[model samples]
Target chain A: MSVGYVSVQWNRHKRIYDACVAGGIVLYLGVFFAAGKALYTGRNAISGEILAMRALATCAFLMLNVILCIGPLARLDRRFLPLLYNRRHLGVATFLVALAHAAIAIGFYHGFGNVNPFVALLTSNTNFTSLSAFPYQTLGLFALLILFLMAATSHDFWLKNLGAPAWKRLHMLVYIAYGLLVMHVALGILQTQRSPWLASLVGVGVVIVATLHLIAGQRERRHDERGSQLSPRAGEEWVDVGAVDDIADQRGSTVTVGAGERIALFRYNGCVSATTNVCAHQGGPLGEGKIIDGCITCPWHGWQYRPADGRSPPPFAEKIHTYRVRVVGRRIQVDPTPLPPGTAVEPARVEEVQSA
Target chain B: MPGLILLGASIYATVGTLFGAGFVLRGVERVDPAALGAPWTFRILILPGVIALWPLMAWRWWCAPRTRGAA
Candidate 1:
């Protein structure tokens, strides 16, 4: 992170990630175009423009599916975290492709009329009563608008200006967009085409996305339940977290205290410290992240904060709430009350507790 | 009706363009200190977002804490 915002702080990994996305898009479009040409010929001939639209549309849809899956996939397994890192790049690319497809489609189908292409596109289709004749283009248009909003605000500037919570809520409109697109496909193309493959593909995608999310949600619920089961130690208000040794060196384990407030207990340098599990940036799960270079690093965007003070290092000004923690025997106990952001709390020494 | 809608959109676009020009040049630095020394290319890239969100940005600019010589 930089003190001042640049367009993007390009790194070797970002470069490689972007290159792979670009190469994949180009390869997919090429294959789609070639396949369309080879299969649809003579009586079943399709125009190159229509073919291009189809290619971009399908590619954008698949990209969005992958984008939606990445979140739960990362939560399910740490190995998928790299995919979650630069997922916004894929999102922006998908929007661009979808925009191109929409532009070509509107220009081809509606531009020939005297009415404005957009107006024609929306107003020409009025047979909404019949499922087959539903105005699917309007659904597609709404979804595109949502995608455009997201893509436009994908930069850090918007995130900072909008505040993380509001920005996150706004971005969650993607689910609505996805739903609209599904209807757009089912009603528009599926009605005309006598193909089970497209229907099966969409069904399978929905199932996989739903299944992964359910599994991840269940796992998170179980984790929270386990943490919640640990009551305040005897009469003391300090909640008993799990064993100090259970948290690996330079790693964190989360515990839920009073009313489901999750706190991450991090062990570093033979001492234990506690901080809020929510990252200051994007609210990433700090508990899932490990401490690197003596700082707790957020898994989502590599935002780092000192484990003791919960403050980002110099020049960058981000902070999270810290909690007073102590090691009682082998178990780490933390005060339920949270100190103000960046408040320094003394780390409890594991050796001292063991010796006592 | 289509013509009226198109005209309204054109007016919105024009207003957005004017607002965006001022925002990228001066209003940005006032609202966000991090945008103070941002590169021209970055500013250009953020213009669409600024235009789309001009009302909010303008409000922020208006309510920005006054630094010495900022007023």
Candidate 2:
């Protein structure tokens, strides 16, 4: 929320969040290495280098799973919202750990060969057609490249410059990267080791991620469908959303207008105002956010916009479309037509409707 | 085969480094007023991104309207 950019607008929450991430990474790696040594002894012993590589690889995979889960989990329940706040840090950390694993594996396997390690990584495994001996390293490499691009552009500077839509489209490549990494593990270790436990772990992770996303998607679809039912039909001027009391003070209730145009109706200072449900920063659900200090704050990153005009306060040049709202006999009705972004429409006073 | 790729990457990175140094020092403020008066840490933190994206930065630097206080 700064007028100007610093490296990061680091605060107490971010500091604590990063500390927890660091501690968890260290603990996971330590336990992994220790368990490997204790479990696999003498005849089936693994070297320290291999153990380190495996530890980092597993840690990165688990971190990625958690990262993917955080969004759907947050949508399902607000308690997980705290996890969503510092997710990019976790993502960057995942890349670093994965890079470490790649470095170790490449060096150990191909560093001593006649050609470059990367070249050996690409050329040594030319058996792409064979399912049993496919070039899984290439999948991992491409995934790493995607991760690197994401980590590189994770800053607000890039977000602001690229515009939210383009930035979002670019970051959505994470799904592809996730898919690649999944295949990388399936084809790499699962093929060679034939470890049931590892296979089960990957299977469970994929299931959990898929299930959570499906559940969240269903919930959102239902919300939109409900809004659609309440929307104004042909020739109808205003659509009745619900009673003003349905929205809590300083809180919002989302309604879908004509053809899936989602609007967030906010109640504040005895008046009701409406704005587009989409946040300008990250397309976060603005309806789920509350009015903080006379401004509607985005739940995702706390970017605020004045509910009256849908404008972010001075020095923050973001805006969302405003909708015309009216209260008639305690019932809130919003015009299906949207005004331009930052257009000021008079709010309908709840007290006026109550008195009438 | 890998040596050629590595050499090309090295060259690109070298050019990026030089361009990034100048962009961070003199050109950043012109493109983004927010970067003006930003600390050394901020500049250093953005160095890698700037290096990786030097061409884009250069394009923005060349085209974006000059902000106040930028020399």
Candidate 3:
């Protein structure tokens, strides 16, 4: 959205969102540290640093769970959309907490070793084969690395440079990171601690995350497979996009052609043109966007493109795959063959030839 | 940087095919023919994570009846 790079395009909403996140972290640590201490009083004495690390670890894990849940929750209900807007913020916080956890663990567990601490971490943790005695620190380290990559590249600059597909692919490592963290906790603590409450909490988090993803994925698959194919196909085929009236003025409708990228057919100014549903910026759904000022504005980032040529207006040279569309009777048919990135084509106008 | 990413993507695409035929049959869109047919790089670049996290993407794709801000 920004023409130039700024550290962060912070707004009142972002400020409030980050504040709540900070407050939540503080509150959770305060409560958990106090409660954990009281509960474990009769057992072997636990040091404050270790307890603090554990608290941060748990918080980061919880925060990640919340972050992952937001995507699915938003899809299930519109109310969760606000959380999605600031998800990257939540991700950065999670990384900080995770980093803190690793720092404390490093200084405590590996700091005293004569062989460089980093070297000792790998050398000391030799039990990689055993399930019960696995080196959970290694798992944690891998998870932290993934988190670091995601957090570091969270900015729009990285997104723009890397391109949407690449950026999304990189960030998708979060799920792998999640899986690793779950193992980090389960094998690391549950194997020895045998704390039913902690086990239950981790179990709950996994169940919630896994269940929501499944439900959401199933819903999406059902929808795409429901009636027709929308995206373009191999060897070029004509697909029914839907009725002309189905698309409102300055609006686009998506129709699945078969198995490929989705195509968006836009109706504007008594004419219709079709383009790839995928937006160049962040792969936002173009079909979901609206035409304003005679340009299609992407819903995700508001990147505007001319309806006639599928090209973003001046100063922004983004282009999308445009399709040839024609109207037959009342039904609209789209040629799924995508033109070059920015090919200009005459729009198929919905003209009325009235007998005078 | 993109070239390096492409190498990584190739590795991912290979693994995706070796272990993802069932996944593709199971409806993994990242490695579909449409995605892989052209340069094959797009599928390679996108399939790694798509195969890794198809559930979330699928949900994101179709969970909503109408996309927000749609006219």
Candidate 4:
């Protein structure tokens, strides 16, 4: 876990995983370019360069869609976690393919046109005011730049330097990039191509991405609702999370306190401790992870924090808000107001029940 | 001037790729040893992209934690 500085440590699995991706890309491009040539033979006046460019563009766009889906897909099903681990490769490959498409497009459309291709790429399209005639090339370029930035910073090294929260916020810009790409394709190629099938495909892609995000949000909302519904054993300030017996060893029972922030009540050894359920790294649910080596480990990235103080161990400093907790008999009571992150607090011990 | 810039960029990429081959062989394998195995031909597939952006990777490599990976 400590080797964060080295090049991606390649193992047999990553080797095979990357090989499959390469093979898939080649197969997709081969089949797509051949199909385009065959389908448009004689009927359309499209050339090889244009056809190849379109094939790569379509392939890259499809990959982007799949890459975006992997996040929500993994959240909905643990089975998809393997795909999530190597997702950065897919993103980098998409950018490379998209770069090829851009290269060919510029060569054919803008090359030898009395102006420098680089300059032409900008000044050639200035009809941004009109929706139909909007400079879609500019949008595509904007999206590509975002993709480039994301690919550049995809490594853990960048993640550690940027800090996970900031890194996550930076990567979230992809949603904006996706929106720009959708408009670029709809206004640019779809206009010239004039196919209902193409428009339907774009519409379907948008719907799928939107639907997956909505469903994931709703699932989290339901979990929050259930956590808030449990009643307190004492005053309004201290909520009864559950009987200490109900909390699994090393894991926590989440409870929503004031302002609806969820708190994870963990039982480690004979004691109980609580922290913000939202992990500092990508907001992962910390209540789900087991304690490893006496520290609560984040399931998403294996980041550890002391349950009592909610602070990560040395060399990696991350903190989460902790709550004051105490046990009354077998029932666990937690104070709603969370201490600032990294504040030390005593853990509540689970009372051993005596024989009748 | 544009042609010269493109030529310079290509040259820079070539050097990065040359350096990246060893980095990928030595250090890259440690970044996520669990996921990747010993370098193979297929791993070279990522070389162009990796080298093209090697400056950032180099910087990250320098900035990353200095601890030796666990056995």
Note the B-chain TM-score for every model: 0.86, 0.89, 0.33, 0.67
Docking class of 2: medium
* Share of reference contacts kept by candidate 2: 0.44
What value does the lDDT take at residue A98 in candidate 4? Answer: 87
Q: Model 2, A301: alpha-carbon shift in Å?
A: 1.1
Worst lDDT 10-window in candidate 1 chain A: A347-356
Superpose all Cα atoms of candidate 3 onto the true structure and report the RMSD in Å to 1 decimal: 13.4
Q: What is the C-alpha lDDT profile of model 2 across B1-71, one tens digit per residue?
A: 55687788789899999999998888877888877798887788777778888888899889988655445
TM-score of 4: 0.71
The pairs that clash in candidate 1 are none
- For DockQ, candidate 1 versus 3, the one ahead is 1
**Cα lDDT for residue A172, candidate 3:** 97
Q: Which prediction has more favorable lDDT, 2 or 4?
A: 2
Candidate 1 backbone clash number? 0
**Model 2 per-residue lDDT tens digits across residues A189-282:** 7567866889889989999999999999999888877776776767878889899888889998788864757889999999999999999888
Ranking by lDDT: 1, 2, 4, 3
Top of the candidates by TM-score: 1
For model 2, chain A alone compared with the true chain A gives a TM-score of 0.95
Preferred candidate (lDDT higher): 1 or 3: 1
Error of 1 at A137 (Å): 0.7
Q: Cα deviation in Å at residue A147, candidate 3?
A: 1.3
> Quick one: best DockQ, which candidate?
1
TM-score of the second chain in candidate 2: 0.89
Q: Residues A35-93, candidate 1, lDDT per residue (tens digit)?
A: 99999999999999999999999999999999999999999999999999998899999
